[model samples]
Target: MAKILKSTDLECFQQQGYVRIPEAFSPVDALAMQDFIWDKLEEKCSILRSEPNTWDKHVTGLNKSAENTIYSDIASQRMCRAIDDLLGEGTWEIPKKWGSFLVSFPQKLNHNWTVPTNHCNGIPWHWDG
Candidate 1:
């Protein structure tokens, strides 16, 4: 059965770029997913040590993991459902640009290292330009 998102959920998603769907996954499920990703990272490490050329060829290790990971179950189901509700079914087939989910680990900075200035890439200016 498909879970119906409430009006509040829609409003929150509209105002903010994203919204947190509470209790979307059980604690056990979330932990399992974390373990799954960690296992993939370990596999990547092992592969890289055995075959350094493979690592160089593929910058992101996600492709290997994506194939092994079960999208039908776990976290992906919730994301797919939300996307369907917001964009309508089969919207994924449409050619969209600049949409991705990224996860990064924060690194501790040394005394000698200073914070670097970063800028957001602006959208293409049509009328002004």
Candidate 2:
């Protein structure tokens, strides 16, 4: 059985259209998962390095092979718990398009990176969807 979300959590999600789960997973657990992902990535890199011609069929941007494992055991458990908590039992469904993970490396900016702006057309537009 999962813990029930508080009234405040429901209200916040309704108002903002998204809710942040603070400290949902421990820092230690997160770092361990990250290390696991890096290990898989390194293995893929090594395989590509050893066989140059196989690169065309296997490697993509950042050497990320399409078939490479994305979700770790810990991550899968966390996501399952989150889904159960948010939507109740049997409500979770696999998404048609599972997204890719991105890691942005910091580099010295050549120009002032202005924050992109967009207008929020709130609930009326959202409800119409």
Candidate 3:
């Protein structure tokens, strides 16, 4: 059922533990979702995309809106197939709604931000797999 039926992709997944699937969903849909997130960030955290000074925090958290149906289109059939390829059939559960969104910003030089020397100090380094 996987769109990436080719073994090369599977080999990449096996070796790297992740594979990128291009154009799983429409680009316009992705942009819409991005705009929605930016709007929420500005609304909730006052983190304006237009202002770089507002982007102080390295990471920001935002809650997902249940009423918005735009998030639903992200998980296309192609994406599901890719998931199936990686995780195997019926091994994964489709999300009912997007729970949370974490936005990461670049650390500004002016900010008193110290790079984490140890793993547990700040953002812990780890692989997804």
Alpha-carbon local distance difference test for all models: 0.53, 0.52, 0.75
TM-score per model over all chains: 0.52, 0.48, 0.73
> Candidate 2, residues 1-129: lDDT per residue as tens digits?
655456687677778766666555577766765765455545654423344443333332543433334333334455556657668768867553344444332435679875445336542323210
Clashing pairs in 2: none
Question: Which lDDT tens digits does candidate 3 get at residues 8-89?
Answer: 8889888887777888778988898889988888887788989988988654446546447877876888888888877788
Assess candidate 2 and give its lDDT: 0.52
Q: Write the per-residue lDDT of candidate 1 for residues 47-92, one digit (tens) a residue.
A: 3334434343323455445544443244456655766777777767
Poorest lDDT segment (10 consecutive residues) of candidate 1: 94-103
Runs with alpha carbons beyond 4 Å of true place in candidate 2: 2-4, 22-29, 40-79, 93-100, 118-129
Ranking by TM-score: 3, 1, 2
Q: What does candidate 1 score on TM?
A: 0.52
Superposed model 3: Cα runs more than 4 Å off: 64-67, 110-118, 121-124, 127-129
lDDT order of candidates, best first?
A: 3, 1, 2
Error of 1 at 96 (Å): 16
Looking at model 3, the pairs that clash are none
